[model samples]
Target: MVHYDERTPHLHYAFVLVVFDAKKDRYKVSAKQVLTRHDLQTFHDDLDQDLKKVLPFYEKGILNNKTLTFENVAEIKKNNDQFKALKDELANVEENSNDKKAILKITNQELNEVDLAKKQIDSFKQGCLKKHLAKP
Candidate 1:
């Protein structure tokens, strides 16, 4: 879904991106607002280029045959569990406590791990998409 606002001289656009995660068996939908029209084309071009880069890997069957192994799934689940634990600990910490910063840092690290896991799943989804579209 996409919408354009042309109330003023400048134009603003909003669009939704739907990405599938085959490993997790879910869809990750994100809505983005583009303040400048010029950047919209750049965003589309960048997205296309990124998908193109993954095509060769998909063709090689690396991403097609095994999107996520047992180990990968376990690692992702472990990271998610660790992130939840850290978030709970951070919430219990006092605002003025000296340990707050350290806890926050650890929480951020765990969040990054979760993000990486999501990226891996998304890449696998892209590969699946390519394979499906390529089939006659």
Candidate 2:
């Protein structure tokens, strides 16, 4: 997802963006919000123009036939777990901002270690898959 905001012709309000992709059984779906019409056409046009700059490549790369490397798979799992832990931690961090950053830093470091393990496992799977693909 990508976003850019305009400053002129508006000062306080912000144009927003939300995008998501979901895959199921050989079918992929994508959704986008180009404009919300929170203000006049000028503000909305600015958002659309910015989206035009950002959306094409994103749509192509994510929508097209792309192959995931072992690193990519590992990163995905790592990010997922990191986000999950972050979500939980945010609930308890309303009081201690200092400890929150420290804990988050440690959590991210641990996530990297797990990511490395996942990368190794993915590499092993790719090796096995490659062998099978090569067989008659």
Candidate 3:
């Protein structure tokens, strides 16, 4: 998970959203989202509005007896080390890849890094969802 540090004070937790295929007992992360107390008011407002769209389900689940866990509203933070590493890699690529061919290769490497970041975020979101939705 991207954790908070000196650079980002707003990040606080992690979220994980997973979609399971019962027939296969396999799951995939469909989305990764986050919430933070720094924007708690806005977040709650948005959450309330979203819940309104699914009022029936909310009434049946939450209003009856179900409750959402703190896991549902987790925080996000920045990893300075990770950011530095990425920056260093990009700097190295820029320093060495002056030719078009080398630049293209470096660009692909950057793309891979971006994809990895996306997957990491997705995994965190899925984890949060799993915890939030877990039933007693």
List, in order, the clash count of every candidate structure: 0, 0, 17
Relative to the unseen true structure, what is the Cα RMSD of model 2?
A: 27.5
- For 64-126, candidate 3 gives per-residue lDDT tens digits of 223233433232223445678899999888777667678799999999999999999999999
Q: Rank the candidates by lDDT, best first.
A: 1, 3, 2
Q: Name model 2 segments beyond 4 Å from true.
A: 1-95
In model 3, the Cα lDDT at residue 65 comes to 29
Query: Could you give candidate 2's per-residue lDDT for residues 1-136 as a string of tens digits?
Result: 2334633122234444544534334433322344433433255356556766878742222212243333456798987898899988986675578788889999999999999999999999999999999999
Which residues of candidate 3, in runs, are more than 4 Å off? Answer: 1-98
Top candidate when judged by TM-score against the true structure: 1
Model 3 Cα displacement at 82 (Å)? 53
TM-score of each: 0.29, 0.27, 0.27
TM-score quality measure for candidate 3 = 0.27
The per-model lDDT (C-alpha) reads: 0.65, 0.61, 0.63
